[model samples]
Target chain A: MSTSRSSASSKSGARQSKVTVNSQWKAYLQHHRVTAKDSLIRLLKSPGSSIMTWLVLGIALSLPMTLFVSLENVKQLSRVWDQSSQISVYLKKGVVPRLAQGLSDEIQALPQVTSAYYISPELALKEFSAATGLSDVVEGLESNPLPGVISVVPSLASQDAKAMEKLQDQLMHFVQVESVQLDLLWVKRLYQFMELGQRMVWALALLLGLAVLLIIGNTIRLSIENRRDEILVVKLVGGTDAFVRRPFLYTGIWFGLGGGLIAWFLLSLGLYWLSGPVEQLIGLYGSEFVLSGLGVKDSLLLICDGVVLGWLGAWLAVSRHLARINP
Target chain B: MAHVRFDNVSKSYPGGHHALSGVNFEINQGEIAFLTGHSGAGKSTLLKLIMLMEKATQGQVLVDGVNLSRLGNSQIPYHRRRVGVVFQNHQLLFDRSVFENVALPLRISGYSSRDLERRVRAALDKVGLLKKEKQSPIELSGGEQQRIGIARAVVNKPSLILADEPTGNLDPTLSAEIMRLFEQFNDVGVSVLIASHDLPLIDRLDHRVIGLKDGRLLNERPAGGL
Candidate 1:
């Protein structure tokens, strides 16, 4: 009976301590909420300054993010083009249609060639005449001068750019072919340019990110000076540096977050604004490709980046200035 | 009990302006003491040293047995939790209500909401400004603002309270009322040390008084007995 009574009392004490801890946490959160509310209210009160700061940050942040998204879009386009890279070989005149077909079948049997197509000289001449708007000129000719071309398309499943080039060169040695043309130069250069552009975008983004930090730091310094008296009061009232810095940190976060949202909006706006013109241009070229905006994953990353930058800027400002303003 | 001890403490600014020179004094527990001095006599510096706002260039400052000079950065907040301070300018947060100002210390010390509300109300009631709890400090008179400062200082039930010219901006009557409030807190076992140069006001309070001249303690007297 005595043991049971002691155990019961101990359990009650434990329960009491747990309740106390829970209550303490609730109170802590309540205080933080009050502080956060006051901070937001203060920011709202000075809407002009807040807006100005946020705009500066947003513009700064948006430049890199927009560039990054554009670069990503470019990357996607390049990826599609890179995968579509294939060599098209056209044969000379007087190659028999049946011989061209046999050559195509042989090329298709090769491991390097994914597929090959045999176009008879008659069909080739007809297609050329239609494409160039020179059907009357071809009609007056005595014979179809166009070649019985065997087009070779290589597979990208293997990693062999040099091997593919060599294979294209070796196809020129065929007895039935007079000349071979491989149109891979422009595609290779285009891929290289896209990669270079991505690197440049990253470098520029990093440099501008540092500039944003400095801007935020200086702004926070001015804010600290403006609110020197308030800070002194807080310090005198036994507020820790962390407690004193909470609001400024929130301000910085808000700046970053707001700036990020603005940047996202601006990027989307730019993409939306450009889409119609780009689609019309593509239609003129008889292409069905549509320009795409930032994808879901990328948009999320941009928002996270904005918030982090704002947080980092605020942290930098507070650490540098709070040390100088003692109670 | 809140007592402050300065042992061979000295403070010199970076530009070689010596604010305090080997200052040594002991304020006993529950004693209401006046740190009286002329302008730039290091009265402010002394209070700052005790509050651990400024580190001593030499020697140590101990408050309630904690050596502030040796305290770590993280531990500074814990040290401050034991002391309540009021500034010369009242330095009340103008953005907050009087009740919220009083609740600042309690909030920092992590007091529960129910306890914070109760204690803040009690502090405002003690300062005779309970009705003005919802009023902003900026909306109040100078004396009322100083009282709010006082309420903030004492709300946490700290063992020691330091006021640096808390009434410098107030009239004589208001100054006396502020001193009375400090005395009332002192009577209840909270040590009070106020830095002021108002001779007449200092003469009226029956408490210990320490005088500083040129960063050195010149004399000390027992309130009206001086």
Candidate 2:
């Protein structure tokens, strides 16, 4: 009778096990959902401290990000300046306006030149006076001292130092050209400076990323200590390491999400605050350049980085402390 | 086969304090036994070995015919699931409701929500705390809290139950009630091994007793032989 009872139950158990295979996946997802929601609620419950942690993480995340966006704007500014770096060919005193115009047309036809424009002596004098506020002093001269000038913009392919120098040497061979000047030294220096700045930004980002890890790790460690009893009880009641680790991991992820959003907010706010002043300053430079903040892709990246760092920090903290709790 | 077997098991701490030595015993399937000893007599250590909370310093521990020493780290949770444990302090999470507390093991085992709810209610109903399922364990009385712990232990329907000083903080009547609860589970073919120093209670219950003294096996008393 016992054998028959056991066999019948075993048959039913086999059927139940088959159904459990599908339900097991559902249960796993449900647990994750529950843990994630519970962790988020825990964070919401302690809004004061949660915000404090997020703020710390935000500040850490924003420091390098602020530098990065500023560097991006500086790069944009350099590109504008780079396009303006042209060969200024000053003609001899005897050269007439029509001859200067012809020379400009000839230079424009060169394969290396993108465009060339002749600046009459009068326009150059006016620009010089307007820039220096010395119009009256320039009007006192009997003859216009400024020569007819031809400004030559090299093609995109010839923007490098060697190519610009070569174009300068080529323009110097013109008979009407008195001197062909290309002040590319400062542009080259600026390029080097920007490169160095980029390296510095990367280094700063590395350091700050480490700071973020340490901050999150320390926070998680303290939380683990606070929930030590819960952990002990869970372990005592057949909770797997992964099961015990889930809620804390979710906490870390929530922290990361909040911190990322905050960092993005801080960055946008900083750019917005600086934008008006920056536009006024660029207006003084006589260029209509707009200051750009962290764009959507970069904002998403920042958040993802925050999440990854938070997870890593929590994992590190939990692993270290979990090994010590035997119960 | 025995549900729990200790073959000359011995355990020592790092400082050379032996918690158990040459302890050999068995609690057969569906048999209820009491582990009786004074404080520091390795009763807890013996339970720990069965739960894989601590490894024996020497010899073998076989539970439900599986050699525990051979089980890998990842398999420990699966092993633990087959054995339920009730702690002396009745380790309930005060942060949650009694229902959630009892649902913990089932949750850890990844039970479906419907099954979890049903089984949790069943366990709580068995413990006679079904009405207080929504209340926090912190608000419950000592006896109720202990019963909640028992509910959590039995919620997963484990083959064996081990209680460490389960009735230590209870009055005689409450303690007897708890022991009778264990008896009810044993009647349903679940093996039970409870560690306690309450000799009078153990004497009255009249179950088999495995006695330990200074980390060594002292005596084994059959039911009604005291």
Candidate 3:
């Protein structure tokens, strides 16, 4: 009986503390909601300065985001061209068309080669005449000077310079082949250039990210100075450091969120403005490539970046300055 | 038990300026006392020690059986909540209304909305400014502003109230009225300490007096025997 009574009372005590914890949690959330709303309202009250800060943050956020997205698109375009790394095998002038077709069949069966198509001397002459508009001059020759060619396209996995060189050496050993041609230097150089561009973009992003941090930090510091009296009074009245910091942290979030949205809008506007001209330029090159803007995933990431930077900047400013403003 | 206790407490500034040295006093729970000293005589520093606003260079200060020196930074806010404070200059935020000013302490303490509203109104009513709740404190007279400050201090219903020259600018009549207000709170079992230089006014109160001069304790007088 005694053991049961003690257990019952201890359970009751546990429940009592649980109720208090629940209420305290509720109160904590309530304060956060109030502080967040109050900070947003304060920002809205001062429209001119708030808008300027948002604009400045937006421009800063957009510079790197713009470069990143543009590089992504350019990388996609180069990837398409890179996959087309092909080798043209020219047969001797006197080689028979049947032997050339046999050679093309054998090349197509190679592991690295994707597809091989044989172009007869007759078809080659016709294509050259059509391309250069030199049919009568080419027909004026005693016989067709153009050689039979086999164009070998490598698989996507084997598009690198070393793999192309290996394939070229194999093709040169073909009995009917005269010369093997592969433009290897430009392909290697383009790969290196694209990698450098990507690294440069990332470096720029880091520098600009630091700039954003300093901007937000300075802005919050000025705000802390402006409200020096309020902070002192709050501290005097028993406000905790966390309580005093809630509103400023919320303010930083607002700036970050607003700035992120503006950057997204600017990127979309810029992409839209450039898309038409970009399409026309690509069309002139007889290729159809569309310029893409920030997708949903990237846009969300940009906004999250702004918010994180804003939070970190505010935290830095608050921790450094609030300590000095003792009651 | 004493609501506030200082045992050989000493405080010194960075440049070796001792704000308080070898100060000792105890205000038992439910007692009202006045701390009298000239300007720069360590009255403020003694009160600051109680509030944990300034740490003592040596010795201990206790409030409600808890050593203040042992309290960490995070515990200071809870300690201040238990001890209400009224400043000399009526540290009221001019941008807010009278109601909001009194509600500041309760809000800081995270009172529910219903409790906050009812308690704020009660505090304002106690100070006789219930009807002026919506008006900005800047629009009120000096005495009214000070009353608002007092209302704010007591809004959270702290066990102890510390006033630093709360009536420094008020005339004799207003000052006596403020003393009566503190007495009323004392009558309800709240320990009160007022730091002031108004000797005549302090004499009229007939409360216990703890005197200090040049960072040293002078003497103590029992109530009704000053």
Instruction: Please tell me which predicted candidate would have the highest TM-score against the true structure.
Output: 3
Question: Number of the top candidate by DockQ?
Answer: 2
lDDT of 1 by residue, B3-66 (tens): 6888998999999999999888887665678999999999999988887878999988888677
What is the per-residue lDDT of model 1 for residues A1-327, given as tens digits with 9 covering 90 to 100? 112222333232232212256776887687678767876787789999888887887788778777776776665565555555666667766667778888889889988778888888788888998999998999999977776777777766432446666887778878887777666677667767877888888898898788778877787778889889878877766678888898888777777777788878888888899989878986785655668788888788887888888879889999988989876
Candidates sorted by TM-score, best first: 3, 2, 1
Off-target runs (Cα >4 Å) in candidate 2 are A1-19, A88-113, A116-151, A157-181, B224-226
Q: DockQ (C-alpha) of model 3?
A: 0.21
Candidate 3 residue lDDT tens string, A121-172: 8999999999999989988999888889999899887886777788889888
Report fnat in order of the candidates: 0.32, 0.37, 0.25
Which residue ranges in model 1 land beyond 4 Å of their true spot?
A1-24, A65-85, A88-113, A117-150, A156-181, B14-18, B222-226
How would you order the candidates by lDDT, starting with the best? Answer: 2, 3, 1
Candidates in order, interface RMSD in Å: 12.2, 4.6, 11.2
Measured by lDDT, the strongest candidate is 2
Worst lDDT 10-window in candidate 2 chain A: A1-10
Error of 2 at B172 (Å): 1.2
- The residue-level lDDT of candidate 3 at A236 comes to 87
- TM-score for the first chain in candidate 3 comes to 0.77
lDDT (C-alpha) at residue A89 in model 2: 92
User: Which residue pairs in model 1 clash with each other?
Assistant: none
Would you list the clashing residue pairs of candidate 2?
none
